[model samples]
Target: MRRPGSGTRRLAGARVPVRVRGRGRDHGSAAVEYLGFLPLLLLVALAGVQLGLAAYAAQQAGTAARAAARTAAQRERADGAEQAGRAAVSAWVAQRSTIGGTGGCPGDAVTVTVTVTIPSVFPGVDAFGPVHRSATMPCDESN
Candidate 1:
């Protein structure tokens, strides 16, 4: 037997309270949990993007270094090695990069070094520093 408008039911003439599962007690819990975890998820995503940017910057630095070294190896283009290095990378990367090197045609080889600051996704955060890459090329004996 059961009573109307009551949570209890009669079993063998004894009243027992009905136990409810996953009712109003847990309402909106998922939304709350998701809200709590949202910040962490965003942070992880931002970190991944930042890491990718750093890798790109490193790759750009390497390209710049190689371009500069190759240009410096030729006596006729040695003076434009820095300009050549800057032109080899993206505008954004070149804007924050520095190129320096030694050696030229008379020498056995030419070496060039490029340093670029890693761009940050987070404002005012510089957790990752500059990326540096160096390259060497044989001098052009004919030049």
Candidate 2:
């Protein structure tokens, strides 16, 4: 049908303009979405860091156990055996690992057991518990 603009004015009066509905262009939509998801990203990053730290601690524990066992097996049950082992591994660890035990690793067949309590990066969350790493080495029987 010819509209009034085309010189045909019949049906209704002047045609009412159709209003565009719904939402307009969201200029800040991406920014808003990223802001909403930032917290989750940060949490994941912190968890990753915590996992790395735990793994490092576990490796250090194993190193300490091996070193202690080797030293104690051949040594004369000296007082510095345990301290040396603890220091050797603490060089890599966070200096917070609890390393100590009786001179049980001073026999022909020495066994050193290292235990470390993993620290948490996130509060109130314990992903990995205490880790225990042990090593045993035969003594130098030749004295």
TM-score of each: 0.85, 0.73
lDDT tens readout by residue for model 2, 78-122: 445577678777554636565555265445676777888888998
Residue-by-residue lDDT tens digits, candidate 1, 36-127: 99999999999999999999999999999999999999998898899999999999999999998844566798888899999899999999
In candidate 1, the residue pairs with backbone N, CA or C atoms under 3 Å apart (3 or more residues apart, or in different chains) clash, namely none
**Model 1: ten consecutive residues of lowest lDDT:** 1-10
Report how far residue 55 has shifted in candidate 2, in Å: 0.8
lDDT values, one for every candidate: 0.89, 0.72
Task: Tell me the lDDT of model 2 at 29.
Answer: 94
Best by lDDT: 1
Candidate 1 regions off by >4 Å? 1-7, 17-19
Model 2 ranges with Cα > 4 A deviation: 1-24, 91-94, 100-107
The local distance difference test score of model 1 is 0.89
TM-score of 1: 0.85
